[model samples]
Target: MNFDAFLHSLTSSFTPVIDSSFNPEDYIHVDLSPSNALLNQVNLSSAEDIELFLENFLRQNQKKVAYGGYLEKRSIYDRSEHFSSGSSVQRRNIHLGMDVWCAANTSVLLPLDGKIHSVRNNKNFGDYGPTIIVEHQENEQTFYTLYGHLSLESLDRLNVGVKVVKGEKLGELGDATVNGNYAPHLHFQLIKDMHNHAGDYPGVCTKAELKFYSSNCPDPNTLLKIY
Candidate 1:
């Protein structure tokens, strides 16, 4: 489906990714930008530091969940080769997905009806560990969604052609060490075109490729509606 039509469908058809306790008031929408003073105050240069930061931040906010980081320029990515290893011209910082920050092992629900398209363990520093991709058909158009940084146990019993009902418990968020060595969270992305990619897609891209990827992967908030 084209971007505009796909967005309309999500509003009507998809369920919340975290359905159990989804009151918007119970969660804080965070901005992980360079100017966020909290990052500097904590010296967030390591995965452990991030985990601690999120913990304290959530406690202070009187919320159990903290979510954001879509299209955000994050410094946390500097810890791994996935973003900074590339040449200066190709350096990637813009996150292409909406992160659902919660405790590890929190269930990740399927937002809509779908079938498994591919699955793999993207086990690199700052990568999607035990990623799962699902293909959905609506209005005679096919699209895909990627769920990243999932627990290793979540991979069990998944098959390429198996159908998953909307609102079903599909997987759990992975721990920091397993989830690309970062704080526990779910990286949820909606894609119009997989671009022949499977089990993996660029969750971040350089400014040079922003125009194309932004269209290919529209703001996940169209489905998430978290703000």
Candidate 2:
């Protein structure tokens, strides 16, 4: 099925990214684009700095959680070569996943029934630490869902080809030390074409390839239905 049909199917079946008790209203949509003033004030290079930013921002907004940052151009990637745009390839600044900011040990739930496709600990500054990609099938059309920035413990018993049900306990939100040194958050994404990549995928792409990447990775909100 196409992305539109896949999204429509969600109306009948889907799962929450967090606990069922969570309320959508409690989540504040955040902007990590270049135009955001807060980015200019805080040194995101330090995970602690991002943590501090999250704390103050959440308190001020009177919200318990902060989310968003899909397709956002982030300067935070400048910390490591993993997101390098200075080489032969074009500069990669646009983010491709939805980031959910919360407590360090908060649970990250599965959004659909699937089998464990791949798992890896992409240990690097500004990387996806302890990542997991689940392969799913809907109406005979297969797609994949990726969960990044997870606690190391989450992978202890995880293995490839293992079946996982919808809304299952996928993992917990990892701390900065194991979660690519960013603030505690979950980077959730949907991929129509993995391009043979396993255990890792480009969650961000250069502007030149935006057209293709955008179509490959549709807006996660289409399934999440949360702003």
Candidate 3:
């Protein structure tokens, strides 16, 4: 089976990346893509503005968690030079992972049994603040999962090669001040190949790079089964 198929076979039901107490029904699919007309009213550059919009969104929907955005083209990146430093054609705004938006400090849980591969504090303006990557294997095949935008304290005692089980708490979500200045959320991605990367990988790609990146990073919902 191919990588996407392999991931689907690993889980039989909805998988929670945050607190398990939240059932699948608690998650509402959110649209951050440029196509979402509502985003046009908010100030995309300010973390506080985005947070307030997100709060209203969740409150109106009566949901505790907001998720989605695999392979989604977002304009929010336009606010940061980290993604908008290049020409228009070279701008990297297509997201390659699934974002779980919720309250800050929410527990982030492991979706699969794996070992800590690497961890780092990417302090760029629009980057993953505290990140963790875990390596997993099944039937001789190896893959990886990335958890980004975590609390600084999450990396305190973590060490490379430490074993972790599914559903185990890996860390808590970081706030705007530390998590790339965005609303609190977990950027969860399934990587088929690390490409020698550790604790860091492109979570977004430009249209020109989509062909290769879309292949390397599959839709995370394939494993989470949250949709």
Candidate 4:
């Protein structure tokens, strides 16, 4: 699918990150942009302070910043399922979503103006730490996208059926402990049918379920327009 067209179909503010002008076609194979903070500024001395700042920022601005995905050769092949298992025992089932690496509290945005179809906090290490599922309909097609690993405060005030805008800041990435015990990042994903559930959705899939998962959760770069 044309990622750019799909993105524009969902959002009007997306400007494809391009050199001269925003060209979605030219970005088909472009690398992810550099991390001005995570791999550069975040350090031990600043970890706590940065995390605190992130929390407050989310409280103030209420938006989420994206971080990791398709960075040249650094990305793990989407089909590779043999990732080293984390402490959670769920074998790191090949990252299915682009990780928005950032300090805890970085606000996450709802890419498309949508309604809260579901929301849940799967409280387990290496799990989707405090997640929200937003449902969007475009061209008669109903789809769902998930934002996982969020701050506790993000969910503190939300409930089902809440209205949100395309650029509305929905939540923030949480600290390691509350945000799935990893360097803080938002796990973003797209889903076709939620099957039947609320407050929880699978953020990862095994090889046996790859085909279904892929079809359900389309590439989010389509909406994000980030190369």
For lDDT, the strongest prediction is 3
Query: Tens digits of per-residue lDDT for model 1 on 1-227?
Result: 55766676666633478746667677788878898987887655677778888888889989988888778887777767778745877788889988888888899998889999999999988899889999999777788999999999888869898999888999899997788887889999989899899999999988888888888888887776666
Sorting all predicted structures by lDDT, with the top scorer first, yields 3, 2, 1, 4
What's the TM-score of every candidate structure? 0.93, 0.94, 0.98, 0.66
Report the error of model 1 at residue 150, Å: 0.2
Instruction: Specify the poorest-scoring 10-residue window by lDDT in model 2.
Output: 7-16
- Model 3 residue 152 CA deviation in Å: 0.1
Residue 5 in model 2: shift from native, Å? Answer: 3.5
The lDDT per prediction is 0.84, 0.86, 0.94, 0.60
lDDT (C-alpha) at residue 10 in model 1:
65
* Model 2: pairs clashing at backbone N, Cα or C within 3 Å: none
Candidate 3 wrongly placed segments (more than 4 Å): none
Tens-digit lDDT track for model 3 on 24-101? 999999999989999999999999998999999999999999998999999899878999746999999999999999
Question: What is the clash count of model 4?
Answer: 9
User: Which residue runs of candidate 4 sit more than 4 Å off their true CA positions?
Assistant: 1-8, 12-66, 69-92
Q: What is the C-alpha RMSD, rounded to one decimal, of candidate 4?
A: 8.4
* Position 29, candidate 2: lDDT: 87
**Candidate 1: segments with Cα more than 4 A from true spot:** 12-14
What number of clashing residue pairs does each candidate have, in the order they appear?
0, 0, 0, 9
